[model samples]
Target: MREEDDKMNEHALNPSRMRGRRNVFCWFYSKCLDAAIEKKWKHWNCAKCEQRHNRQAEPEISLQVNHNIAYYEVSVKY
Candidate 1:
């Protein structure tokens, strides 16, 4: 039982959070937004990055949006 708890703890997180950041960062949120749309998911969350995105709340609002910012964010971050 303890081992199970430990495993869950390893991947657990608050309903909303940012992995290494105190706040939700833009790029990760944007990417997660894209993924949620692609997969037709209402929401998407990445435990590793601790980014949770809601497709409807993001700019993937059924319009052509520039991903340049997200790209730049990734390049600068990485």
Candidate 2:
């Protein structure tokens, strides 16, 4: 009871510290997909470090789409 309640509170607070982590990855993945579908190069900066990178010739375009689908599936499952 009380211990379970404390654990729940800890879990709730943990994500606030991890805010924007998932969004950054999702945004980057989507930008890469869009670049591939449009046949153009896209650039992205790291959310944490601001390092620039380009999506010029990714070999796993299909894998990115599959990953996005899997993420959605997991969200729905939970």
Winner by TM-score: 1
List where candidate 1 sits over 4 angstroms from the true fold.
1-23, 50-78
Question: Candidate 2: how many backbone clashes?
Answer: 0
Q: Which residue segments of model 2 deviate by more than 4 Å?
A: 1-26, 40-78
Tens-digit per-residue lDDT, 3-63, candidate 2:
5346434542111212233233332444434443465434332344221232433455465
Clashes in predicted model 1? 0
Worst 10 residues of 2 by lDDT: 12-21
- Tens-place lDDT digits, model 1, residues 1-78: 465346335653333233232224433354445555676765444654433332223453456546655443334554
Q: TM-score each candidate.
A: 0.28, 0.19
